[model samples]
Target: MLEKLQPNEIVDSIYQINLSHLKEKGIKAVIADLDNTLVPWRSTEIKDTLTAWVKDVKDAGLNLAIVSNNTSSRVHTLSEQLGVIAVSKAVKPRRRAFRNIASQFSLIPSEIAVVGDQLLTDVLGGNRTGMYTILVTPMSNHEFIGTKLIRQIERFFLKRIKNKST
Candidate 1:
């Protein structure tokens, strides 16, 4: 159970992810968490850097999708603006959304990489489905109250994972 929460890789931000490395690993698609992973929570503003990164991913021949636990309107609106696939109200740590995206893309679990800012949701969900998982630091300190609470528990696990690494 604890191993399911472990991320395959940890990066400070999405920008740091290596596109070439993903391709080398046979990752043809990337499913990303919307809030905090791509942008700050509930923020409609899309940064220029993010826009460029999306283009870069596409240019690298990778499919991209945005999955969020937020409302449809919020997720659709942003995903449309970015021109990527979107799945709203995903309820992560559950495998449904991830599996759905994989099916939609006609890709197997190993062909997809899941990237997100939360351990409980992104890492666990991806790992459960046998997809590569990348954990990125939350973009801002501001987030949902429930998420803040989960962060406390996440910290304990992070410490354990780090200690084990040594």
Candidate 2:
């Protein structure tokens, strides 16, 4: 059960992700978390670098979706700016949104990757649906109170994984 929360890849940020490599692996879509993963938890505006990253993903011929547990308005706004689909209030760790991404892209589970900063949400949810999962460090130290608590728990699990691997 705990292992399901483990991510297939860990990176410092979305920029570190190899879009071309993903395409080579036959990845057809990416389901990414908006808050913390793409931007700060409270930020509404998209950064220039992130804009280029979105363009690169699209240029690579992979579909993209921004899925978040945040409000629809927030997600929709960013998704529009990034020119990707948005799934708001996604209640991650559940398979509903994951399945939705697959359905929306007309891709199988193995052909998509879930990207986020949270293990409980992104990794666990993606793993549950048998999708590739990538965990990136949060973009900012600042986070919501609920996310802070989850981060603490995630740190513990991450440390355990690191120690075991070493």
lDDT of 1 at 21: 99
Clashing residue pairs in candidate 2 (N, C-alpha, C atoms within 3 angstroms): none
Q: Provide the TM-score for each candidate, comma-separated.
A: 0.98, 0.96
Best by TM-score: 1
Instruction: Give the clashing residue pairs of candidate 1, or none.
Output: none
The sequence of per-residue lDDT tens digits that candidate 2 reaches over residues 101-158 is 8998889999999999999899999999999999999989898898899999999988
Query: Which candidate leads the pack in lDDT?
Result: 1
Counting clashing residue pairs in each candidate, in order, gives 0, 0
RMSD of candidate 1 to the truth, in angstroms, is 0.8
